[model samples]
Target: MTNNGNKYLAGAVSFAVFAGVVGPAAAVSWTPPGVTMGVPLGAAFAPGIYVSNLTHYGDGPDKSITADVPAFTWSTGWKVFGASYSAVVIPEVLKVQNKVTSKDFAGIFSPLLIPVSLSWNLGQGFFVSVGEGIYFPFDSDVSFTTSGQTSGWAAETRVAFSYLKDGWIVSANTIYGVTTADDIGRRQPNYFNVDWTVARTFGKWQVGAVGYGAWDLEETVTNAAVGKGHIVGVGGMVGYDFGGSKLLLELTRAVEQGGATNYSRNDTHVWARLTFPIWKPAEPGEEHTALK
Candidate 1:
């Protein structure tokens, strides 16, 4: 793993310099692009529609960009409801350039993810959530791997806490991976991540800062074979909430790469997302309705 880290660092530097003019989209956010993957546990599920794009670079075999949509569902009381479907698609150019020749690659390989998670309010602004998910490689190319790509299963778990004070809010979340594509000969190791966000609102405008970190518990790849890797990222965002609709724009940078320097070796990534209410709101005269 040590050797792989050194090699990855060298490759990462060369790649960064070669691609010197780091594009605007690359600095969008330090976290995963979707609201589902970033959602805090125990939050009420409000039916809505969301669209997002996630692009990753630096790692030789791990470079990819995926665009996705999240379809939300809610149960009565909203206390114990779950999300059923979520998916993503990758454009063609990225597939060809990265030598991601195979559709059956591992580690951020799939274009879609189906997650089923439940959130519960523990009272007093704190909450707990737990869920499971599957990664489906619907349009992958098996022969794309020059060294052979890996495609298989991935399992995830999430836990979090959130608080609202005055007009400001804060949330902390942690995600853990138990099993993945390792069965298919890929070294996808276990990992844990923490995400924190501080937000406030004024009029119809919402603003906030997001900070997060990740640690690899096991080294499934050579670069991560030794001690776990660490990564710290921070970004700022502003959004508009129009009673029933919301749109947000964000910019983030990776300030530190602890061990996965080869994997997420870049200094920054740019991102943005737009979300809309797919469901009609209750009549203005109606009170805030709670769905179970």
Candidate 2:
């Protein structure tokens, strides 16, 4: 019989072992400046920080987990051949606690995630983006289970589209992910994620509703007619644009789930992101200087 034990362990380990553990909301929460996925901001650099708090409450009272993550991100982009290309790197610190056991695990300098993407403006308020991301296990020694340590790489590809007109914004982003096998020869099932947002702008502030869902594509080892991993969430988001800087806040609650999913019922997630331009292109006839 296929051992299903590793599947549960993989879920928990993936959360605690990776830097992107902000929660399911993190998978689809970010919207690039201008809320246009296909329009490329030219020759700019942005360095920002994000802080997230996530709480997970399983069906059993002893299954509660809480985590706080502080992440630092750097992004740079340039225009290329009528398309925009950008890359981002994120590194994070993790602090997770088990409410029932009162046990805490603090991880410093977790894995790093690098994503590279290219976008094209399809004109008439339509845009498209295609990108891939990779996660490098920088802290491979940390283990969430006694069965084995977590050490592996992950990779994913994403496609996104958006429409913007008259201060109204609508977009959808999707991702597919797979990971390498762990020391115990257990591999995480391939998964698909979908995220969407709809918002209207009022001067400098934009308000919207956001939703996300994830589903595992493969069946579990036992083939016990159990549904694959699945979870869904919905929330509200607000943002303000300040010239070259922007601030965004979002809160979401898990509304649906399958037994094999990683999230808990009624799980809550809160996220805050601030981004500011570090470098900007020169204006017409402007002198190029390091200070500028």
Q: In TM-score terms, which candidate is top?
A: 2
Which ranges in model 1 have alpha carbons more than 4 Å from their true place? 1-41, 47-115, 137-150, 182-184, 220-226, 280-292
Model 1, position 26: C-alpha lDDT score = 11
lDDT of each: 0.41, 0.47
**TM-score (C-alpha) between model 1 and the true structure:** 0.63
Worst 10 residues of 1 by lDDT: 17-26
Top-scoring candidate (lDDT) = 2
| Candidate 2 minimal-lDDT segment of 10 residues | 25-34
TM-score of 2: 0.71
Any idea what lDDT model 2 has?
0.47
Residue runs of model 2 more than 4 Å from their true location after superposition: 1-14, 17-81, 108-112, 140-150, 221-225, 284-292
Clashes of 1: 17
Per-residue lDDT tens digits of candidate 2, residues 1-292?
1232222212221353322211111111111111221111212222222221222222222233333332232333355665555565544444445444455455542343545666666767666777777766443323321233454566777787777667767777777777665444445556777777787778888789877777777654333334476677787888788765566676666677674444454656555655544544343222111011
